[model samples]
Target: MHSLSAKDLTLGYGETVIIDGLDIEIPKGEITVLIGGNGCGKSTLLRSLARLLKPKSGNVLLNGEEIAKMKTKEIAKKLAILPQSPVTPEGLTVYELVKQGRHPHRSIMKQWTKEDEDAVQQALESTNILHLQDRAVDSLSGGQRQRAWIALTLAQQTDIILLDEPTTYLDMTHQIEILDLLFDLNEQKGHTVVMVLHDLNLASRYAHHMVAVKDKKIYAQGTPEDIITCELVHDVFQMKCNISCDPIFGTPVCVPHGKGRSVGANQKKRAAI
Candidate 1:
């Protein structure tokens, strides 16, 4: 029962309490995607779980113990977190950046070990950035830079990984590639992945557990099949949408009601031209 959970989390900045008394039990060895409208406290919650943000009240627990009470290195060994935007040091190569993830495992007296080298190499390979290892991170394309950052997180080799919007600036193909890579990590290594995703369609396809946050609390949570519906979308996102199943993965797809491409009887008649 390896559980990383937030119990009674009153998360916020200073006195501006955003999340008031929330509890979420992260399913171990599964992909959990947190979805919410902007400023709904989803990313804040993830940071709280990683001990990066202190809760206004209550506790974030790792395996039944309070994460806030644990040593930083101990917490790092169990969980690795990638923020929405990370600042890369100037002139630092990808390998140099990835190697930093191994610092938690190194003692004051111990230098870089064979294990560290192997971990960095493996992480680079896993993220498909092995060829770019020697290149400076700042010089890479947006997608490449993102993959480099992901490789750094993977290199840490933690059982639990938290990511905040991993596909922010990437194109569609790279977004899918990133998600697919994460899916493989969850499946092959059984790493507990909890991330904040903006796209409902991708979240539905990839997440084993979907937690929809709203108004500083969870609006709904369950399998994508159960949680993603017309009512939930309207309630959480405030958008009228048609709920349909994805043809490829049979996952829930939300076709939001708005002025976009025409897809009615007129669309069919126009296509017949």
Candidate 2:
């Protein structure tokens, strides 16, 4: 199939290096979730893979060729990226936004074609947003807006897709819905899905391969069953947790030990006193 890799990657903002000398290979036709605590560079790493962020050192390779050396349109045809927060122009309808995904394949003279219309329509249908196609993106709720953007990415019809915290601002129901959609895309179409997810349980449920980022490096990488553990969660996230199997998906589920209003960490500490 397809291959994506980062070699000796050193990425960061100006004067701040987030990841240093890291190497990762995206497993073909698998869902890879990048898990880390806040400010651990999960989004930065995703952007680097999509070539949206320039690396401080090294390069991202697609199919063994340096992505930096490829033309922008060429890359767009093979891969797509959906950022965590995307700007939706005021008054722009959902259909218009999804239509933009076809720009990489269109020409000034070629304009609209059957293929473009089919792609946009398919994306809208796939996202269950077909009825909202005429609605202004700015007027939609947060969950609707997220789906519209996801539809745009699907319209690109790329083999590889990278998303950053796609479930942000979505309720639990919608979160599961979105993850289910991505899972279906991978199983049925063989799209190489790479993403950053904050929810530990959801990550474990949906990820075929999980990469735990710790100390700005890869702490572990493998199947969810192999990579997820009570020790890894505590080590990487610095949060005490118990690893259990998900009843529905048969995947690892992380149960965190936290102190809130009831008995937990704080109650235990007070009992010792």
Candidate 3:
């Protein structure tokens, strides 16, 4: 019932609009993946929805309320955003970093309440980082660091969570792990998750819904099973591919036909001939 939507939304930075007149709905209690080529405004649109960037025209609405009108703290209570490549403070412990998420909940009169402590604890535990709470964030591995950042965001306990490339520095294993964690969050907590992902396979595997962006507009948006067809990939990414069921999950799986191993195999066959 609490959907986030944009109506004729245009977004930009300092006089240049990167994306224009976008109408899209981020369905509640679902994991929505945003996929597009670099510079196609995937991150720009995510930031706009999160209210980190202002809209040039039109409005971004959360539960039928214009997001721009809500006070930052009030908005923070309902929304949390994890940007791409967030910078961690040197020597800052994992617990300390996660604790920052409570900023919106704190006031001059109510500094460190029991509720704050419980939130931080729950977030750390949820991320499986409770044991690493005292370790400096910089000392963690790339995957661990990513988990720490996710934990920080989880501590915010917002109904809507926006993640910009949550798997940037991670290996395949870690990427899947993070995606699984996100999927669980959506399934168990009913947190509406919206993320920008570069990996189409991962998006198809983990997302309940997908949005393909291209040419400053929505190329397509729907369930992965419905939207991740070969035509969509060819149109958005300009690549040929085969789309089939995932053996395990039955989600759409893209087999890119013109890149990597497939191209190598073709070239080797030609050379042999």
Candidate 4:
């Protein structure tokens, strides 16, 4: 059974609908990437799945139960969300931030225990931020700060994680690092990861399942090889492109046709010969 799904979901703000009557099921224990152009509702859809956004017309189901009816702490125990460019509280250390993830597991009757400490430690270790645990979150570099935030999510110890553009504003190297970390969490820990990503090529490489959003609906969705094509790119992104294979991963790669330096056709033919 799908751990997360949306049924006839309609989401918007002040009558400006972003997503209308959409339905989607996130495959359990796999990496699902939502891709689309700006304002295409990718983030909106993800937020609704995490119950961060209230839908106008339908329900989000978590573990076959309606999510809207679940208690906040219960939902927190099952799913974790890392929103886009989250703000770090001033003077908060990495360890302190990560420890906050354990809040859902704690209460007036249940104080901190060994389990919470171990979970936080494991999260820092998995994200390779153990060495920076004592450092202030705001003092770390871009990559390190991102890792710290991710460690907070990891410490939640949920089976499912949702992130909105987790790699935004980072350099290409950091972007790959963040994606690779999420990939490891999925492969090694069997966590269900759903995120909105802007880079088509990186998303194709890491995503076990890809959902292309366009025109307030899913344009296509499947493995990259099955659904990512020149036609889909044009229809969804309004761009012309050639579909090629990644030499390393053999996943579909989009090569856009646009103004840039070009080898002449005769030179291309001669080089081919």
lDDT (0 to 1) per candidate: 0.92, 0.92, 0.90, 0.94
Per-residue lDDT tens digits for candidate 4, residues 156-216, read 8999999999999999999999999999999999999999999899999999999999989
Report backbone clashes per prediction: 0, 0, 0, 0
Show where candidate 3 strays beyond 4 Å: 259-273
**Pairs in clash, predicted candidate 3:** none
Per-residue alpha-carbon lDDT of model 1 for 3-49, expressed as tens digits? Answer: 89988899888779889999999999999999999999999999999
What are the clashing pairs of model 2? Answer: none
Per-model RMSD to reference: 2.0, 3.4, 2.5, 2.9
Model 1 lDDT vs. the true structure?
0.92
What is model 3's C-alpha RMSD? 2.5
Worst 10 residues of 1 by lDDT: 258-267
Cα lDDT for residue 244, candidate 3: 84
RMSD of 2: 3.4
Candidate 3 lDDT at 85 equals 89
Q: Model 2: residues >4 Å from true position, as ranges?
A: 260-273
- The TM-score values for the models, in the order shown, are 0.95, 0.93, 0.93, 0.95
